[model samples]
Target: MAKQALGMIETVGLTSLVEAADAAIKAADVTMTGWDKIGSGLVCGFFVGDVAAVKAGIEAAAEAASQVGEVNSTLVIPRPHEELGQMGPWIS
Candidate 1:
């Protein structure tokens, strides 16, 4: 099943954050849907082929981000459309 993981990271230095982000992206085997900087933090959007990939991606991103600053992450295992309702459309 497909999986998605979102990462929120706060960095003390911009250079470190950028470097970490670049490393994380390069390290990832999964597809990265999006990535953006918010203030002094970062938001990473990723899609994976399976649960294992999702977990691995999250761990990799966290490890890389920690080199720069603090990292916080959330993984969402989406349910069926009917269960998600409005959230389904947003995710898609």
Candidate 2:
């Protein structure tokens, strides 16, 4: 498959992460690429798709997550570098 754009939203808790994930999928055509749980109760959701869709999805997710709890960070990479692919779901 061709390389896909990547989107991410990291929230304070699992429930918030789920909320973000739901909004992301609803707002755009994307697929869950990965999920991560970091210490101190941080939860991260990752999605991949077309550039525009990924941007929309991540933005929607961040907005939804913020409504629930603290949003640690958000990322939208239109065309992720090869190094980022190797990094995968890593929080660092």
Candidate 3:
């Protein structure tokens, strides 16, 4: 099974945050599953080959964002099919 990872990052700016997240994702050599913005902050979404990559991605993302200012991040190990199961549940 493919290990899944999710991250929630609180940052100051959107553009820079996304850029940082992107760079971090690349550095970690992982695929970016998705991403979005919430208020003035950003919520980065990503998936990797293993738990280590996910953890590393989060750290790298934080480091990139920190270049500008404070950046807080949270990561989670998602259950397989949970994401898909939850999809569209609240859309309508």
**What value of lDDT does candidate 3 attain over all alpha carbons?**
0.58
Q: After superposition, how far is residue 63 of candidate 3 from its true place, in Å?
A: 0.8
Model 3, 1-92: lDDT tens per residue? 33554444556667656766675677776566555555656444444445667677777877877877666565645444555535432111
Measured over all alpha carbons after superposition, the RMSD of each candidate to the real structure, in angstroms, is 4.7, 2.8, 4.2
* Shift of residue 1 alpha carbon in model 1, Å: 7.2
For model 1, name the residue pairs that clash.
Answer: none
lDDT of 2 by residue, 1-92 (tens): 25578778889999999999999999999898779888799988889898899899999998998898889999887776766666755312
TM-score against truth, every candidate = 0.51, 0.86, 0.65
Off by over 4 Å in 2: 1-3, 89-92
Rank candidates by TM-score, best first.
Answer: 2, 3, 1
The ten-residue window of minimal lDDT in model 2 covers: 83-92
Best of the two (1, 3) by lDDT: 3
Number of the candidate with higher lDDT, 1 or 2: 2
The runs of at least 3 residues in candidate 1 whose Cα sits more than 4 Å from the true structure, single-residue gaps closed, are 1-24, 36-44, 76-91
What TM-score would candidate 1 get against the native? Answer: 0.51
